[model samples]
Structure formats: structure tokens, C-alpha cells
Target: MKRDRDLVARVLAAKRDPRCADDLVRDYLPFIKAETAKFMGRSPQQGRDDELGIAMFAFHEAVLSYDRARGAFLAFASMSMRHRLLDFARRERRHADVISLDERRPDGGEGDERALVETIASERDELDERQMREASRQEIAQFAAELESFGLTFLDVSENCPKQQRTLEACQRVLDCARKNPELLDRLLQTKKLPMAELARGAGVERKTIERHRRYLVAVLLAFTNGFEIIRGHLRRIVPAGGDGR
Candidate 1:
């Protein structure tokens, strides 16, 4: 537990100081390889495999985007690497639009004399969709687990969410304030409590209102700050593009 906190602190510091990025990556190479190897079902060799390079980049990204609220840094980096490798595999599987008409058949028979495009089906889409659904399920499960630390759950967040448009807008404003103010977010994560007074002041919303929608606001803000891309993508409809708090 202490080690995880220390690592997260180092990652946060590295994000502010560009010079530390390389050292950070170097120190975590073994971890990166472990994550990549787990996803690939084999160990990746440095400077010899493309997957290692992708995992390194993903780890760097995780460093930049990680928030302690999202749980352990290693877990976050592992998920990032997994998703990146999956994406790479999908790209590699993509077939060319046109193939030789006289290409030999897979059955070692005579030439088909037909474009490979004709034999292609919608299997790719279905496969991609299945992968996406599985990824989403994993993300939600991780999110729910993190929410447990705050004495909240997915059900709590859903049930506590503001019902009215005006109330929802108020909660969104609070979330916007947290997103723009790193100090506010840091305080929330550090204390495991929301800074209602600071949030109300920064968001220009009433303190009582902020208190009322505290759980919902925390859930939304955590999604944005924690680099939960899947969860955040689903929240686009509720929260506007910019941090205007509208």
C-alpha cells in the first residue's frame, strides 16, 4: 500500500517535470514488460518487439493522466497497455480492400479468380463490438471497486444523481470546477472527502446545492480526473465539451 502511494507520487511529480519522464519509464520497464507479456501471452524483448514499444508509450500516457483516485498506478498502466495491444491487434487484423483476383485458395485448390473482398463478411465489426463490450464491462467493474473506497457504489451514484435539469446543471458546474482546479481535486483525493465550500465558491453555486449532489459530483469528477476514458466517454452527453460548467 505504501509503495503504491509512493509510486503514484513519483508519477505525479514526473508529469510536472519532463526530465523525470525517462527515468520513470526506465525504472518501470520490468512492470511494463510484465503487463505486455500478460496481454501477449509471452514475454516481450526490449528493442526486439513492437509490443514493448507500445506498452512503454502507454505507460508514459498513464503517468501523465493518472489520478490517485483511480486506484493503483500499476493497475491503471496495465489496463492501458492491454487496451493498446488489443487495438494494435485489431489494426493488424484489418484486411486490404483489394486482393489479387488469382490468389490461391486457402484449401490449396486452384486459384479462386475472385477478389478477397467478396469473401469478407461483417465478422470484423462483430468482433470489434464484442471486444468493446468486454472492455466496458471491465472498466465499470474497476470503477465500481474504486467507488467503494469513497463509501459509494454505482447504485449510490445513480440513485443520488440530480433528477431535474437545473439540479443536474448545478452538479455539472461543481464537476467543472473540480476538473479545472487541481488543488480541489487533490484535496478530495487526499481527504477522501469533497471540498464542498471550495467547490461552491469556485463553481458559483450554492453550498447547500453542492452538498445535495455531492455523491454524484464526486463520481463524475473522479471519472474525468482518473483517466477513465471509457466511463468519461459515456458521460459526454451529460457534461459539455468545455469546462464552462454548463
Candidate 2:
């Protein structure tokens, strides 16, 4: 509820605000870590700590160049962190020569061979993790597609609010209204596959109204999903596993 001053504004105003900057890091570091780990495929032995460190480095880079005029902090951080992790993964692979199936173990003993087999197994596990990450990404892609069909934009309605409190309140109101309206709700769900005009016709509303509602809806969903898990809970009931909000 209390948005520790707008980090972007604070950064621009003073050219620095320790508190605001720290708050921004606190708000986004976990997200950066989670997303980066998902993209990089965490190793059971290596753990996520290395990836977390890389993400933090990426976050710091983002903070230096963050432009409020461009986009939300989360969107910027997600893209920045994703690129950082990918680059890090590339560098790591370049440094370490991945062993082949027919390669001999350095120690040349039965015990060494077993250890090598374990290492190869770990590599395979990494591939499996990559597959899972790819699947989740595809799902998110589908989720975005479903949302677009409804003719709503991921527009920033909150940009108009100078104050964070107002922005949060606006998000709440949008969520509340949409949740209470079955026609709008149905349209939102079906939008996963249908076109915006089609969704508007189904909802019996003008295309502009649907567009407006979309910006508001995204704000609330982002807010709820960020801290409360409320949106995910609603999605669970509304969308089945491997199914969009149909």
C-alpha cells in the first residue's frame, strides 16, 4: 500500500535516493532471481545462489539506466535480468568444456568413471530444467495470447497517477469491477483466443471500453499477483492445467 516513493522519480529528482533505491531493489530482486533461475535451469549441486548473484548484478545495471518514461520497473527488470542470465550462461559454457558421452574420465578409474557419469547426469538434468522452463514460457505466451484476444492492451493506466496510493487504488477498483461483471469476466477469459472486436461484440460494449478495461485489469492483476497470489488463485479456478482462461 505504501509505495516507498517512486524510485524513478526519486532517482531523477535527487539523482539518488538511498531509501527509494533500496526499496526498489527489495521489491524486484526476488523476481529477478526467480525469473533468472527459471531461464538458466538451476543445478542441484550448483544451486541458485550463483544465478541470484548474476541477477543482482543485472538489477544494478538496470537501476543505473532505468527510465520512468519508458516502462514499468518490473518489465524493464524482467528483460534486463533475462538477458544478463542468458549472457552469463553463454560465458559459463564457453569457459567449461562440456564432456562427451565417450570421453574418458580424467582419473581413469571405476570410481572416477562413476563420478563422471554423475556429472553427465547433472548435465542431462539441466536439459530437463530447460525443457520445463520452455514449457512454462509457452504457457505464459498462451496466457498473453488469450488476454490479447479480448482486445485489451497491457497499457499503463497507472502512469496517469502521480501518487502510488492512487495507482494501487485504481488497480483495485478495476479488478473489483471486472470481477463483479460476468459478461466482462467471460470476455476476459475468452479473449485468450478471440479477437478484440469479437470480444467487444460478445460483451456488447464498444471496443474502446474494452481497451480501457484492459489497462485497468492488467494493473490489478499485476498488483495482486505480485504480493497476494490472488490472481493465480482465481486463475486456478477459471483455467485448468495446460488450459488458458477459456
Candidate 3:
């Protein structure tokens, strides 16, 4: 009971700090490998096998999604990994079907099959687009759930978000400060609320402005802090002052 309680606390901590998530996953590497080996019928090589990579991604997803309501963390993670393994199998089978087009056929000439493969590839653009869409959907769903914990939603965020360029830049200062000092985020996670006074001071934004746009700040902060990968993919386009926006 005590060990399970500690793990639950650790998972909640991971939800607050991205680095905590990394460390938690590192500690569970043996368990993750065991799960991958179960699916693979042999031990998965750490860097060489795709199965290990998929299992790690699944474990990360479990970290992001697990709550006390979900019961034990490992059981939840095991299920997530199993589902991903099944998805990987399906994707591999589809890839095999497409790649087999390059195999020598007794009747069909190489030029004829090559042309067919090209036409099909152009039409489907198959692999990358489909994978990206699926990944984006999952990220959006998880982000939405996280936002809800703070009594915010996508529509609420959209309506409350700052419209003016200057106001937007002020909000950016808050983000910059949080990036430098992650304690604000840790407080938000612990209390399920933002530290407005300290945040405003750190970012040099007026406290009134922070109050005016609390939900927007919360949404953006949560997205950037946690591992909402696909949803926060636009971070590259947001450049800093006098920087290359990298």
C-alpha cells in the first residue's frame, strides 16, 4: 500500500514536471523492456528494435494520462503499451503490403510495377500523413483533458485568448519567465492554480493583465510545460525578441 501510494505521488509529480516524467520512465526501463519482450517473444534491443521505441512512447502516454481514478500506474501503462504494440503490428503489415510492390514478380515487368507503385504512393501519400493525424488526435485529446482540470476548455481558451499584438507579447513574457523558473509550474500542479503575483513579477507583466487573461495563460503554460507534443508543435514558429525563433 505504501509503495503504491509513493508511485501515485511520483506520477502526479511527473504530470507537473517534464523532467520528472523522464526520470520516472528511466526508473521503469526494466519493466518497459519486459513488456516489449512479451510482445516480441524475445528481448528487445534497446536502440536497435522499433518495438522498444513504441513501448517507451506508450509508457510516456501512460504517464501523461494516469490519474488516481485509473488505479495502479503499471497496469495502466501495460495496457497502453499493449494497444501500441497492436497498432505497430497493423502499421507494419500495411507497410509490408506497399513495400512488396518492389519485389520481383514472375509475370509483371519491373517498369510496370514501379509505375503502379508510384501512382499508388502519390494517391495515398500513405505512411507519414496517417501517422501524424493519429498522433495529433491523441495529443489534442490529452491536452483537452488537462485543460479541464483547471476548469478551462478549448472554447474557453479561444474566447479568452488575447487578440492584440501587445497583449500577446505581454503574455509571452509570462511564458518566458515560467520557462526559466519552473517552480511556478510546480505550484500550479500542486495547488491546481497559478501563482499570479509571483508570475507577474517574474515576467514583468502587470498583475492586472495576468488576471484579465488567466485562462489563456493557463492553457498555454500547461501545453508548453507538459508533454503535449503534437498540440504544442507550433512552438518553433514562436520566436523570441532578437532571436532566430528557433
Quantify all predictions' global Cα lDDT against the true fold.
0.78, 0.49, 0.74
TM-score of each: 0.78, 0.40, 0.61
**Highest TM-score: which candidate?**
1
* Backbone steric clashes in candidate 2, count: 1
Clashing pairs in 2: 146-192
> Which regions of candidate 3 are displaced past 4 Å?
1-5, 8-120, 239-246
Candidate 2 is scored at a TM of 0.40
The model with the greatest lDDT is 1
* Candidate 2: tens digits of C-alpha lDDT, residues 1-246: 024235445545433765666666676666766776666566322244677777776776677765432234454556566666666765675455354445656556656654454466567568647754664464356345434544444444434332455443443444444434434443433333213464454435555544544555453343322221223555444222221221
Give the lowest summed-lDDT range of ten residues in model 3. Answer: 237-246
What would you estimate as the lDDT of candidate 3?
0.74
Q: Write the per-residue lDDT of candidate 1 for residues 1-246, one digit (tens) a residue.
A: 568678877999999987787899999999898878866669998889988999999989888977655546776787788789878868766634334534533534575344355444465677677778777776787788778889999888989889999998888788777777777877776677999988889889999998888888888877766656788888988886545331
**Residue 56 Cα positional deviation in candidate 1, in Å, after optimal superposition:** 1.7
Off by over 4 Å in 2: 1-7, 10-20, 40-48, 98-150, 153-246
Candidate 2, run of 10 with poorest lDDT: 237-246
- The deviation in Å at residue 220 for candidate 2 is 23
Clash list (residue pairs), candidate 3: none
Q: In angstroms, how far off is 142's CA in candidate 2? A: 9.2
